[model samples]
Target: MSEDPASSRQSSRNQDKTWINRLMSGFSSEPKSREDLINIIKEAAANQLLDDEAVSMIEGAIDVHERQVREVMVPRSQMVVIGIEETPEQLLPTVIESAHSRFPVIGESADDIKGILLAKDLLPLILNGTEDFTLEKVIRPASIIPESKRLNVLLREFRENRYHMALVIDEYGAIAGLVTIEDVLEKIVGDIEDETDEEDEDGFIRKVSDNEYVIKALLPIDQFNDEFGAKFDDNEFDTIAGILIRAFGHLPSRNEHVEIDGFEFRVLYADSRQIHLIRLTIPES
Candidate 1:
């Protein structure tokens, strides 16, 4: 018997709707577990009802609620800072080198953080000449936050206050690190690279095809996970190079390859000191 094509297509769509309804039934009745919701989101993503980025964001939004400030802050040691004694000549060069909008002004030491410095504030020093450089005149009060603060709460404060950056403090009130609004939002929406961010000199992750990417070995592991929807353990390693070193038990030479979980990582450029570039492959299901 010949089936009517339009009727058969409509029937298939109806069956799909029924399946989706069954999956969502628990959400309205007894309530679905976290795993159930995650599975449902994944199923929706696979069915093209939601995009991959949207799925990543949904998962991120859930995961971020459980995280605290310490999880995503840039360590104090890595923060770009300006010394209180820095001259206008020195300050301008330092700001230009860092390419950051704000810098923590330090007093005698890193522990003695004075206030926040806006790079644009230095414009007056340049425009009027470097005769007088009073950092106090240009300083904005720093926002101090405890390292234990929940990300969701921090996000609300950021939105309400219009503050872009904050200094993270320990229980003893010593600077632990720093967190920016962008960092918190990145937890929910993924890496939000600005136009001013310099492109990776070695070539950052480039999509060559649907399931393959040519990446710089120095690319941060967290950034990679956000882009690819993969969960690689990032507790001990920061970069793809770090992962390769752990996998090989030594620095990997060019063309060396390793497969962890389901993704394949192949070295594209390297030296004895570091891995430079890599090719990543993920087989489509």
Candidate 2:
């Protein structure tokens, strides 16, 4: 009338294989669920965590997921391209001030993107006595992408294809803008400091008043620290736009507003699906 003690004992003895089950589960051999695999890998990675790499990788992934090429593309209105018949002397200033390493060489309109020209090419040509240089001779092949393509994909393509510049195309197959590898990388990392940057303790841009505000998403963390007179680590994000996106869980649209660390973010305007223009209002530092 009692349970089988010997059978139960043998079953318990066989239970010695539980660790094997767990080991196989780690490799997901038993048709396990999603969390099992995720948990196993996550735990393993956590156990062998590398701080700097993990931080960079995490931020990189977050940055990659949140960005679209359209957000960072140079709108057609601002594009600087060379006409097939244009002289170099007239184009040098435009190219120099823009600080772009390369630009698309096109006809009168963006639709005619012929190729890309390196800004540095002008220096060598000028030094080499080819002052009448036409971009048609020096232009390199250009890569094109859809405006809807995610920034991550664009970055990957740029690397794999070994192209530095891209022409952003809209759904109608018209050039909407341009994007460079630098622009795409800066979206994930912070701005690459150049000699042109002016470091200020009050931040690069600030609010003059409540209704009118200034913002420099490139404002350094030290400047932000001084301006706000607070200590906050910018580990997860670098730009104000990144912070806003994280807070909103989506792009901030026209007139949308959110407050963070005593600063107010008002979406002035953005391109169709991304945050292009934002006004951050903060007290004078």
Candidate 3:
């Protein structure tokens, strides 16, 4: 018996989709090595079969396998932690301020992490106004991973164990940083902006207020100038961070401000090394 041509074509299309999903999942029976899979993906991208975002995500997935936990985990200093002895009153404000779903419950300091505390777990207690709040009651054992752990392996463990956040430890068995499911996913799918992220129409510069715009320091200087209708020289620097560093003559700390070309560039958030977020205010002319 001969098969229907239409049915055969539909089956072929389904097989292709399955193949693409397997590639996306980073488990293809045909492509044994990373290079082989990447080459196939690049060929597909070059042929315009896969869109740019899809190609980029596929490339990111390959890169994730090559990366380690330490490379992607949020630095220890930047981690928001809840004190083990804190009352419900104190904890409520802290949770609201950070807007974080999960926080590490710490004993003496950030290094002395007790366990993971889910914000949702405290919702019922808060609603009932439970004065005698016990940290041990709500805290759950945290999953710990070595900084040297491979992303692919860690991701698999995360799925198997249903772990959302993991405490990354160093060679000394000290809390080095934190890695979340979101962080791991972002490594593949790129930055996942939250509801709090106030991005503008362009999606580069975010609106902070009537006159203030929170801009990503990585925005290209040319795009920055074009976005705000300002004249900023891109000859010496490529990105907004580059220009700011040039102007400051050193790495600017948080709250540092520089007025250039009628724009007030204030460092909304920064570290000793790089500016993460900047608030740019353009006075109404």
- Candidate 1: Cα lDDT at 91: 81
Q: lDDT of each structure? A: 0.82, 0.69, 0.82
TM-score of each: 0.68, 0.56, 0.64
Query: Which digits, one per residue and each the tens of the lDDT, describe model 3 over residues 1-285?
Result: 999999999998887787677556654467778778877787667655688889878787887787788767876867889999998878888888888999999999777889999989997883776766798988999888899999899999989998899999999999999999888888788779998666554436767568878788889888887778878888888889998898888899667899887788988555323676787889688
The number of the candidate with the highest TM-score is 1
Q: State residue 260's C-alpha deviation in candidate 3, in Å.
A: 19
lDDT of 2: 0.69
Worst 10 residues of 3 by lDDT: 199-208
lDDT of 1 at 92: 83
Which ten contiguous residues of candidate 2 have the minimum total lDDT?
44-53
Ranked by lDDT from best down, the candidates are 3, 1, 2
List pairs with backbone clashes in candidate 3.
Answer: none
